[model samples]
Target: GFGWPVIEAQASSCPVICSSNGPLPEVAGDGALMAPAEEEEELARLLIQAIHSFSTRSELIERGLANVKRFIPEKITDAYIQLYTKLGS
Candidate 1:
């Protein structure tokens, strides 16, 4: 399941780092730094990279803010309405 933490971080303008498994990648989109769930070393490298690179952090923050807009109330409701309409047809 997609969790609120990612959304919260994005909306708060914090750069996110999440595992590449499950719905995390979908929720994070291109707004996060992702490594395979079991790849601790890779995750560490990504964390270090993110810490060292101001531009990377800035880009992630911008993209995360944009990605979170997809979850706004109106959009979620509209998406559900669309799906229901499609299913009923």
Candidate 2:
């Protein structure tokens, strides 16, 4: 139900390696290298790949930081306001 790991990793300028199952893909977006959830070996491989691939990892960190901004309080409040306005109409 929660995917705080992605945000935490991104905030620290780390590229997240996450499972493809659940809301991980949506949460991690371009910030993560995703592998099938049940595949431990694939997940490990992706993690190693992330570590060895500096350019890709850097891009993921940048994208992750941007994605994390969307969840900030101000953005959340704005979204709430927009939703309320739509619902109130």
Per-structure clash totals for the candidates: 0, 0
Per residue, candidate 1 scores C-alpha lDDT tens digits across 1-89 of 66789999999999998899888998998999999989999999989888999999999999999999999999999999999999999
| TM-scores for candidates 1 onward, in order | 0.94, 0.90
Once superposed on the true structure, which residue ranges of model 2 sit more than 4 Å away at CA?
Answer: none
lDDT of 2 by residue, 1-89 (tens): 76888888888888888889988888787778888889999999988888899888888889989889877899989999999999999
TM-score of 2: 0.90
> What do the candidate models score in CA lDDT, each in turn?
0.93, 0.87
Q: In terms of lDDT, which candidate is strongest?
A: 1
lDDT value, residue 65 of candidate 2: 91
Cα displacement (angstroms), candidate 1, residue 68, comes to 0.1
Which candidate number has the best TM-score? 1
